[model samples]
Target: MAAVSLVSVSTVKPLGDRVFIKVNAAEEKTAGGLYLPDNAQEKPQVGEVVAVGDGKYKDDGNRVAMDVKVGDKVLYSKYAGTDIKLGTDEYILLSEKDILAVVS
Candidate 1:
């Protein structure tokens, strides 16, 4: 399968319960529909689901269920993830908890 590289980091085999996401670029327009100039536009906290790791841990030694899978568009908290670099590209690896919701 073809995969996009983020942060120039080679394919990261995430540990259990972790996920990889590639942030989507922010829109230039404001919430009020006012289009902000490039200099005034703020960054967006969005990303595309890239890869998923194994399920979460269970007290019984079983894996807990996972809600999101690859290719899911999700909203995350600002500064909620850890950043890594890959060949000049950037990507984030965050716990599933950090993901607020999966965008419809």
Candidate 2:
């Protein structure tokens, strides 16, 4: 799921097959122009990849390639990542498996 993070983009580097994502905020206003309260908002499922790990190592010592890269917008599974707050911003750290698709 997407989360809002203001953390410095250069501060953290993901490890293994993990990726750091800067989540997009849920809509505050509906298409009809009705404003929704915070509690009524649904969590967003899309985010921008801030950082990615060097691919995970295989048993044979070969590195698996990462499909997504920095700045790629992607779709991820809801509730699949670890929630983290660095400074005032929030970020998600998730395995590549948690990412379902890359947004074009």
Candidate 3:
């Protein structure tokens, strides 16, 4: 029998000034607070940091500090960013400047 290969891991490695984010889809609620169908729910405009890129470069040749780290909740603009597929998961690789705000 031929050998079978199984893989399981994260291949996303963000470069400098970039971040790999996994947007969280919004939840649905019915009139009585019940769960609504997936198609009825709207797309999510919020997300959490799955991975953060390295620090950016400053004018003085020093690496600027990264404000956000892994597992940070954030809010982003709707209809922004491009989608990519890594392995079996979907992610968005966008510049830090495009990030709207960091949720506390």
Candidate 4:
């Protein structure tokens, strides 16, 4: 029999240049004060980095350093990454390339 190890969300760690981000909540109201329905809300493209990989390995066996680290608020590409839900929190896992910029 194979051993099954269950991992919790807090212990989740990305691998090989992948980044784990906690997605921000979608806007419930527009800038004009118009309330938007759940289905009408857009997917958020910004999030805070919760975990990151150890960096990708180059052909020369050198590891490429990651530009983003944990706790960084970043903007990612739209429609990119896999969405994950744990308990009441939402998260996304994506490659470092999908991240567009670090929010100041």
Best by lDDT: 4
For each candidate in the order shown, give its overall lDDT on alpha carbons. 0.77, 0.87, 0.72, 0.90
Candidate 3 — what's its lDDT?
0.72
Once fitted onto the true fold, the runs of candidate 4 whose alpha carbons sit more than 4 angstroms away are 1-7
TM-score for all predictions?
0.73, 0.86, 0.69, 0.91
Tens digits of per-residue lDDT, candidate 2, 1-104, equal 23436546697889999999978878999999999999999878899999999989999999999999999999999988887766556678899999999999
The per-prediction CA RMSD against the true structure, in angstroms, equals 5.1, 3.3, 6.1, 4.6
Clashing pairs in 2: 6-89
- Which parts of model 2 are misplaced by more than 4 Å? 1-7
Q: lDDT tens digits, residues 1-104, model 4? A: 11224555679989999999989999999999999999999999999999999999999999999999999999999898888877667889999999999998
- Best prediction by TM-score: 4
lDDT by residue (40-83, candidate 3, tens digit) is 88767677888777878998999987888889887776666666
Ten-residue region with minimum lDDT total, candidate 3 = 1-10
Error of 1 at 21 (Å): 0.1
Ranking by TM-score: 4, 2, 1, 3
* Candidate 4 displacement at residue 58 in angstroms: 0.2
